[model samples]
Target: MEVVVSQTAFNRIRCCVFDAYGTLFDVHSAVGVYREELGDRADQVSQLWRTKQLEYTWLRSLMKKHADFWKVTREALEYAFTVAGVTNPELFEKLMEAYLKLECYPDVRATLLTLKEKNFKTAILSNGSPMMLDSAVKNSQLYSLLDAILSVENVGVFKPHPSVYRLAEKEFDLYPNQILFLSSNAWDVCGAAAYGLKVAWVNRFQQPPENLPFQADVEIQSLNELPELLNIK
Candidate 1:
């Protein structure tokens, strides 16, 4: 759990592109808001919702039947509700609204501010829809901190896909080595690294690294440590 950096990493990085959900924003915060309504099944529903959400994304990607993240999110919610056997229209609506305004992780603001001050171009490359990302960024007051919000909607596919990573390169007009891709999702770290981007895995939950072909250039427990790891200051 301390920040781990490769000696050669970050030297050529000119941009830091982050994953939105789970990396910058807390994905479970939506369910947390409706905990009282779901009672004992709160945690179960939350976990299942997140699991199904990601599963659907990958499944859709493989099937070549792409859907926007918001659609996937709602579909996942419906499945979670069915599995949890608790369905209240009001509760469902509340959870959906909560997601639009999901709370940013505590370290996000300061880390992004640091990256901005250091003259690094920061952006969000996410599976979220543009409307969803816009709401969360505005709600978190991070709209001005980021240079771009790159959504998978643009390519009609989910991440861990090379095309998704290419959006950042195209938007920033930078090569893979000049971009530092950050994500809490280990698979994403591998995916970005496989695509030749330097990656910093923000392992906030202390999860094990993925058994993948590519490894991240750095691993840090929080975004707060990213500045130091990248030698930004």
Candidate 2:
């Protein structure tokens, strides 16, 4: 469903924080590069990898078993390969390396440039480890565009956690409402919103929202729509 939220909901925001994985970087692009090798099961492997990666984070968080996202990613990929009946070591190694340079969405650079020009403090708060997030950012040539790249590794916990949300406030020294958070994951949106950050769910896939207690202030199809929603030029 298309969300028609009021633009006024975003007028008071000062800082802009993003979720890195499915939001800024195209996560499935790893499998995309190896589609020829994987053949018909490429899509299934990619989707399952992503789905299990998220489930592991939440499960680990709930279980108080903290592991860096790099480990979780590898574990998830192994399971995905097993389910898809893919067993090539070289292909596995290739896909893993490909993740370090996942494709940047076309809308990202332009939107970040607009934010930088307008002086909005932009950063990424992701479940990825600092090494992983930094590697992806630099690989995608976004090092200069972001003010910071936050990782759950800092707090030893993942999303929807109050402490992880607190990392942004500590970095920018601003209250949650003053920071406008953007995420493609509905669950991440719920996490930031429930933490009191003004949030915009980047509904890139037009997927339905999660059945969570919190909801985003608005939903946009792309970051290109952000400046208009924020009343920026």
Candidate 3:
């Protein structure tokens, strides 16, 4: 699947920031928890839920209507259920709660620990609300590993917005070039790279190259390989 392709080395990167959802936590796992009740439409609902969530964010940004990730997520799930013609209050609430404690990917902990040990600042810059980000990080036992958990809500907008990217700069007081942004979302990679951060596209699912103005500085299929690319042994 053309997994590993290295371009630039560490190059004075001080902080390694990550995208939270698909990049570290398994977003689809939210639906996985209810697969039995969801039946044959489990995959469809999950896929639609993610798609709608992102679409709502972008749409809200363009429309100048801001809603936190939690609300956006719930609305997205509601839309998915409506489309699937399924209605179950208990299952719905459970699915929403599942996201707060989404299953983390296996490679995440070790990667963060390795970066922490190497003395590199690690953080999550996500479209998630502060509470959502905190829950996921703490639930995954990764809160202690991070130097910062930056949320777009602080800026009152979703990502790909120029203001959203500036949070990292303000938080770390580091120049854009000094930070390396990693995201499984190709569009997010484009956004951060366009905003001038050194970016590594964590292409977890071997998705095709994004048709966007900017591309990743490095690409890897797994987060486990990030340490190697940064020249850590």
Candidate 4:
């Protein structure tokens, strides 16, 4: 993989901050753990759960009716199960437990460890509640690789909010521009950019941006391609 960036842009990043769930971790794998419960409709159930989880957060955040990330996640699961014509609460709990144990992407541990070896600061700022983020990081074996695991719970809001970005800034004691903010979610990339971070959109799905008012500073498909983007070996 190759990344083309001007020398000036390459020189500016000292720290790398990642969005936890879809960026480093594979949310889909969590669905597979519960495939037996969902029968043949596991794929649809998983997709809907993810989609609704995000939608619930955005809507609740906008309406000022903020529920913590855990509640929203559970609600999304409930809705997904209902939509899939399933009615097993115990099965759903098992699925949620599996979600906490979602695996990291194939390249994630290696890339992150490489970044650490190169002495670049690393952290995760996620929409996940503190408890959820902690479990996810621990399960993925990323706890030591990351310097900090930040959650929006401190602010009672979600990503795309400037305050959430501030959590990263405050943790590293650096300005937003000094941090390389990466997310699989386009709106997050846009929001971080607007907040003055140099953004990287990990376009794992190869989809176009969702009409955000701003664009990412860089775009790449995988963490395997990331080191080259920042001129790391």
- Each prediction's TM-score against the native? 0.97, 0.97, 0.96, 0.95
Clash pairs, model 4 backbone: none
What C-alpha lDDT, on a 0 to 100 scale, does residue 198 get in candidate 3?
86
lDDT of 4 at 67: 88
List candidate 4 segments past 4 Å from native.
1-4
lDDT of 1: 0.91
Show the colliding residue pairs in model 2: none
Per-residue alpha-carbon lDDT of candidate 3 for residues 1-233, written as tens digits (9 for 90 to 100): 34354435565888999999999999999999899999998998999999999999999999999999999999999999999887898999999999999999999999999999999999999999999998999899998899999999888989999888899989999999889999999999999989999889999998997887788888888999888888874
- By summed lDDT, the worst window of 10 consecutive residues in model 3 runs over 1-10
Residue 136, candidate 1: how far off, in angstroms? 0.5
Candidate 4 has what TM-score? 0.95
Model 4: how far is 2 from its true place, Å? 12
In candidate 1, stretches whose alpha carbon ends up further than 4 angstroms from where it belongs are 1-8
- Collision count for each candidate, in order: 0, 0, 0, 0
Against the true structure, candidate 2 reaches a TM-score of 0.97
lDDT of 2 at 42: 98
